[model samples]
Structures are given as structure tokens and as C-alpha cells.
Target: MVQRLPLDAFFQRETTHPHKRYMVQPQVGGQIEELSWAQVGNQARRAAAWLRAQELEPGSRIAIISKNCAHWIIADLAIWMAGHVSVPLYPNLTAESVRQILEHSESVLAFIGKLDDWPAMSGGVPEGVPTVGLPLRPAGRFDSLWSDLQAFEPISDNPQPAADQLATIIYTSGTTGMPKGVMHTFANFGYTGSQAVELFDVGADDRVLSYLPLCHVAERMFVQMVSIYAGQSIFFAESLDTFVHDIRRARPTVFFGVPRIWGKFQMGVFSKMPPKKLDRLLKIPFLGRVMARKVLAGLGLDAVRYAMSGGAPVPDALVDWYQRLGLEILEVYGMTENCGYSHVGRPGSRKSGWIGQSNPGVDVRISEQGEVQVRSGSVTQGYYKQPQLTAETITEDGFLCTGDKGEQDGDGYLRLTGRIKEIFKTSKGKYVAPAPIENRLAAHSEIEQVCVVGDGLPQPIALCVLSEAGRKELRESLQGSLVELLERINDSLDKHERLRALIVIDDVWAVENGFLTPTLKIKRAVIEGVYGPRFHEWMEYGTLVHWHDEI
Candidate 1:
């Protein structure tokens, strides 16, 4: 029989490898701090002891608001060791959104770690609740500092939680509705994290860059749980401005990015090398290989043996472009409900637009309504305090209904068509799926991000944010290149799916702008809510590509 060890079991076992460095944190001004496994374990123990002294109940809820940092992981482990459920809030959330999550979760205490916007985030925490500040950057005035806790006597024995015990209450950053807290057990994380390490062949020698939000399940698994499971050394990115410099110093062997980051990388490349010249240079064999190596090295991805992208569907053309530069960007398909252990595109997967085969021990099937349904040990127990929502999300047959519409190929690779709720019917009574069309349109280097919206209109329209290349083209050619690109896209799409016009917007979508979620997914409903009323005016303009103000 398989033993169900507690999640903190990894920390206990670290005594066997006490001297091994587990985390490398880069500070400002190029300073570096390395912590051994034993040091991390001791900090975690002291943290747990500190929590225990507070007299909170074993299952009390604790919130963590911070960027990706070594102390973030320490706090998470400490929460579990204290037998408390952790609730992670995104550092980029507005004060109101943060208040809503904290109030809803009934969090007893919060740990404030590294933050970019503390004044806004501090306003969200309830006035009476106690707070602890992490080592590097604190969100607000803390009752105690994480460093001060190290002086306390470490807990002699850690709380040995059962496998099925609640580990975390992860709130989904919904685009439209209020965010819901999804509950997952320690067993759920252990099963999925182990499977991922095995599938990706993560070892103690592997190095990883922790720059993504640890609050998100994808980064939580890839950076925190996987690092603990495999005893890998984790590197923390200091800040956005120093991300490239930090990565260069770490030289991580495994890396993961959202589609938006990959898109930005492509734009950065184009800014240095014009597309036409780069295309010409790539045609020459030996020179092309050398150029690719130099590019990857400059981006600090030269040592990356495994790279994956999730949170949004990366355009097929973007994946192809990276592969040409000798970096294969594998696609990941999963959600917060399943601990993010779903279908993953393996290395060298040639099939375009597919998210690859099902992960080991995961069962996936397409329902009659075209929704992707999955059943796995890693699936969450349910949404916290929302049984009706949980029942609606998970079927009676034990499958979690992934809201995404998808189809499985003969080779077992899963190809997502569009979101079921995102499919809209036009005034002509025809249904259109925007993802495929958007995917094709995103192939154009000028287009940074595109959203297709037309709920009750004659047809759908494209709301596009342009890259620097696109901005230059617009200034020089009056949207001439963009118009041609849209014409080509229309030729390939069905009549209903064809865009009425390409409406160019000047503002870039960002978390602070309320255009993107913390995970960097485009907020479709939010976008539609802002632009839906102008569809008729845009259609009547009778231009193939129009500016946003034209309405």
C-alpha cells in the first residue's frame, strides 16, 4: 500500500540533505543570499511555532499576499505545519478585490511579503486582524517580523496533517463574476506535484526561476511544490525591471511563462532585429544556429531544458517561431480545480494548436455539450462554502467540467476550440467561436493581443492591441498592413466568424489596468462590458480597420 505522507514530510526529510542549498534569492544591487534545506526547515518550524503561540485554531484560515519569494514558500509550509489552511491573494489585485477575498475567506491572520503596491493592498486587510511581515518587503505595518520569529524556539514536532486535510483555499480571479475560493487537500497537491516532477524529469540538480505569482496554481506547483518534492534549488526574480538580469545569474534549467510573457519576448526580439532581416539571416544554416544560441543566451534561457506556457492559448505561429530559435514552448492545459495536472504538450510535439496528450493518471473526455471533462486524483474536493457552485462545476460522475470546449485527436492530443460561455450568437442567428480566428490573427507580428466580441451584433469584430512593430506600421502606412492581415484572416474564416472590423486600441492590457487577471489572461467579459455598446456604431463605420475612437 502507498503511504500518504504529510505534505510537510519533505521538510522533515531535508535533514538528510541539510547542507544542500534549496533557495537562492537575488536582492537589489546584485546581492545574493542562499539558504540550505536545513535553514529553510528551521525558519518554517519557527514560523509554525509563532503561529501556534497565537492561539488560533488548527484549521484557521491564514492569507499570504506577496510576490514569488523564498519566504513565501516558507510561510506556506509554516501554515501547513501549523495545521492552518493558506489563502493566497494576488499582489496585483485592487484594494477592494483584496478586501472581498479576505472577508469571504474569514482569514484570521495574514503574512505580508514582497509587494509592489502596499498602500493599495493594505487598505484591503480588515482593520483588526493581526499581520506578520516577511523578510524582504512588507505590505503594511506588521505585528511581528519574520526575522524576529527565527529567535523563537522551533516547534519540536510538526503538525502531521492527514492527506485529505485542507491545505489551501485558492480563490479564482474571475473575469466577470466574483472570485470563488476553491478548496484543495494536501493529497491533491502531493499527487499532482509528484506526477509533474516524474513527467518533466525534475531532479535535485535542476534549477528553476520563480517569477510568476505563487498564488496561481501553475507557479505554485512548478516552483514551490516541485522544488520541495525534487529538492531542487529555486531562484527568485527580484523585480520586473531586473528579471532578465536575475535569470542570467541563475541560469535556470527549467522555465515556465504565460503567453503574454512569451509575446513580450517576441516583441523584444523584433525591436532589436527587424523581421525581414531576421528572416533573411535565419535562412543561412550555420549562421542561423549561431544567432539562435546568442538570442537564447541573452534572454537567459540558454540552460532551459524544459519550457512550458499556460494560462492562455499561445498562437501556433508563436510556438513555431520559438522552435526555430531552438526553444520549444510546450503548451499546458489545466485549471485551478485540478491542481493543474492535465494535458501537457511534450517536447517535440509537431501538431499545431494542440495542448498535447493527457497527463499520466488523468482521464479526459469531451461531453456532448462540447465541454472538456476531467477525472483525476488531483481534482479539488470542491469550492469552499459554495456547494451549488461546486456541484455545477463538477458532474455527478466525479468529473470536473472544464468550461473549455475541446476535441481529442486520434493521437490523443487535445485541441481547444473556444470557451463554451465565450461562444456568441450573432444577430444572424449563427454561433461563432473566436479562439481559432484569434489564434490565426495573432500570427501577425504587429498584433500583440486580439479579442473577438459581438454578442448581439451582425457579426463579430476584433479588438486588437498592437506591438511596437504594429504601432510603427500604423503611423507609416495608415493601418495598411493590418488591413491586409485582416483580409487574409477573413478569407480563411467562416462568414459568421469573419470580423466586421479590426478596432485598434492604444492602451496595453495589464493587471493594474483591470484588463488582465493576475495570471495575465485577457478579461473577455470585462472587455466586452467596456466595448459592447459600440458594436453597432463600429459596424456602420464601414471600414475594414478602424481606430477605437471612430465609434
Candidate 2:
């Protein structure tokens, strides 16, 4: 049996292991920076000492606001080392939302990184709390993290936190209200890390590109934890714009991405060589191998040994398209409450349209209502402060009410249908899960963002926002091509689930517009309200076919 270990032990273990590379960061405009296990551990120790000097009580909540960086990991380890809980905030969160999270968590201190407007965003820091800014620029004000580390002695003694003690509190946006803090423990993270190492064959030889927000549980668990446990080197991408450049520079052995990023990669490849050219190349056996290598290398995916996609449902077509290029895009299923992964598609065990089998030590079952329920050591104990919500979500029996509707096959592969709350009922009383249908429509290389809505209506409809490349693709296609694409989508759906109409919009749905969460998850209710009336007008006037349909 695996014993429960404290979070800091992972780092200490790596420090003692000779030849272990702890971290690597691909600088935006400079050379690749590497850190050994000893170096990272020493930095984390100094950070812990600094936290101790602040005089905060053990288990005090501390917040981190920044993009993915080396300092972010150092700060996180320090927080755990000092027997405190870490709260990571998304870089793009609004001032109001940031204030709410800090206030809700009762955070005592905050560590900030480079920002566009520091003073304005710093206003979110509660009164009487100290704010330390991370100076990306050498001359910036406030005590620099590197400078502080140089001044303080490294804290060596490890204070072991109980297995049940809270480790981290990750906030996730809810459908109807403010985000809730999902409280996890040392056991939750440690066990999940071990399980991932075993399942993915993660080892010191693996290299990971850490670009996604550490605030998100998916990245925190997979990229961060897997690296620490397996002694893999993690290279941070400077930003989204430099993602491709960084990926090529790192040549990572493991890659994890959201569906949107994966879809963009596919679009990037198709843009260089159109489908006709690709189809023709496939017919030539020797030429196909030559062409595939050239294309994969050009896209910076040539060295990626394993690619996984999560955070949202991925379209089957997108997975197949990548698989054709010798890239097996494994679809993983889990959430913030489950420490990011409960099920993952394994090599030689991948099945289309399924999220794969449950990870070891995880128990997953489909309820009579089709809601997916999971019981695992990695599962959160409860919500931070909402007892009622916790009770409703996690039962006394220890199963977590996943809130996602799904089904299990005889072989134990799980296929997600939709969210229990997001499913809509038609006027004919037929319940429709928009996720599968929406994923199918969005699978077309052109679509970017899509929302499916038809509650209390005769049939469901889809509101789509085409990508820049998508709009260009539509423009180049013949009028008959557009009709054929729509017909093809319709054929994939059942009669009741077929989209009544499609409305393509030029505007993007984003957090700034109140149409998306900070994590880029669509706020479906908000979008429905904004576009509901317009959709009705188009349907009544038969103006839906117009490219510039007001609705």
C-alpha cells in the first residue's frame, strides 16, 4: 500500500537523488534556464523562511497571482513547506473577482508577478495585508524574490502536515454564482501524483512544457505534480503568442493542452497544405512518410511522445485527425474537485468517443440519472466554507457527485454525455445534451466558439463564432461547400437533436464580455440571455441564412 507523504517530501526526495533535473524555463528572448533539484529546494527553503518571518499562523492562506513562471513553483513549495495553504489566481481575473477570492479565502499575503498595471490590480489586496511583487525587470521596485532569497537563510527543517490537512484551495466558477474554493489535502495531491506517474509511465526522462495556468487544477496536477514525482524537467512557455516557439525550443516529451489549443494546431497544419494536397500525399506510401515528418517537425510536435487533452470535451473528429498524423491525442476526464484526473485514455487502450478507463485507485460509476460519480483518494474533502454545497456534492458514503452526465460501457470506458445542469429539454419533452452535439459541430476545422440552446423551444439551435482562419475558409469555399458542411453535421445527429439553425457571429465570446469565465469556460446562461431574443427574430424572419444575420 502507498503511504501518505507530505507535499514537500517530493521536492526533498528529488534534491537528494543525484542526476535529477528539477526545472527548466525557456526564456522569451534569451537562452534556456535550468535548475537542479538542490537549487530549487534551496530557493523554496528561503521562501519558507520569509513566510515564517511574516508571523502568519500555520495554515494561513496565501495567494499567488501570476502567469506560469519558475517563481510560481518556488512560492507554491514554500507555502506548503511553511504549513500554509496556497491559493493561485488566474492572471486575467478582473480586479473585482480577485478581490472576491482574496476576501473569501481570508488571505493574509500575496505574491504578484509582472503585470500591465500593477497599481490598479494591487487595489484588490485587502487592507493590512502585505503585497510582494515579483520583479521580472531587474530594476522594478519592492523586494525582489531573488533578492529576498539571497538575504535570508534557507529553512531546512520540514514541518509535516497531517494527511488530512488542507494543502491547496482551488476556486472554480459555478453556473449561477461566484466560484467556490475546492479544498484539497496533502493526501489528495500526493496520491494523484503517484497514480499519474504509474499510469503515464512518467519518469525522470520525461520533459514537460508548462504553459497553462498553474491556477487550473488540470495543469497543477499533471504538469506540476507529475514533474515533481517523476523528477521530470518542466519548461515554462513565456506566453500564448510564443507557445509554438517555446514548444520547438523545449522539444518536450509530454504535452498537455485544451481542446481549443489542439484544434488550433490542426488548423495551423491544414493552412499550410490544404485537404486536397494532404489526401493526394497519403496515396504515395514513401512520399506520405516524408511529408508527415516534414509537417510534424514544422508544427513542433515531432518530439512529443504523449499528448493529452482535457479541461473540456474534445471532438472525436479532431482526435482522429491527429491520430492520422501519428499523434495519439488522449482524451482525459476529471475536474477541479478530483485533482484534475480520474480517467485517462492509455496507449493501446484508446477508444473513440470515450474518456477511457478510470485511473488506478479510483472508483467511477454511473448513477441511475446518468450522472458520473467518483470515489478516489485524490477527491477533495469538501468545499472550503460551504457545508451545504459540500454535503450536496460529496455524499456521506464518500462518492463525489460529479454533476456530469455520462455512461459506462462493459469494458469500463466512460463517455461523457453533458453536464446535468446544461442539458436542455425540448417542447416535445425530449432531453438533449448539447455537449456532444456542440462538440460535433465545432469539430469542423472552421468553428471556434459555440453555444447550444433550445430550452422551451420546438428544437435546439447553435450560436457559433468562427475563428479568423475559419472565416477565411468559409469565404474560399463555394456556396455549395457551406451547404454540404451543414448537411454533413445534420446527418451526424438524431432528428430531435439536429440543430434547427446555425448563427455565425464575428464577435468572440470572452471574459471581458461577461460571456466566459476567467478559465475560458463559456458562461452559457449569460450567452443564452444575450442571444436568445436575437435568435427568435432570425427564426421568424427567415434571416438565419444571411452571413450577417443580426440574430
TM-scores of all candidate predictions against the true structure: 0.97, 0.94
Q: Deviation in angstroms for 449 in model 2?
A: 2.1
Model 2 RMSD, rounded to 1 decimal: 2.2
Residue-wise lDDT of candidate 2 within 385-435, one digit each (tens)? 999999999988899999999999999999999999999998889989999
The pairs that clash in candidate 1 are none
Instruction: Encode model 1's per-residue lDDT on 1-551: one tens digit a residue.
Output: 24344456475557669989999997756789999988888898998888888889889999998888889999998899888999999988888888899999999999998888798778888987788899877545688888777877998785678888999999997887779899999888888877888899999999999998899999988888888777789999998998888889889899999887888888888888987798788779899999888888988999999989988889888898889889999999899999888999988765887889999999989999999999998899999999998999999988999999999999999999999988999999999998888888888887888898888889898898888766776454857778888899899888888888888987778788889888877899888878878778887787798888545
What is the overall TM-score of model 1 with all chains considered together? Answer: 0.97
Alpha carbon lDDT of each predicted model: 0.86, 0.80
> Clash totals for all models, in order?
0, 0
Model 1 root mean square deviation, Cα atoms: 1.6
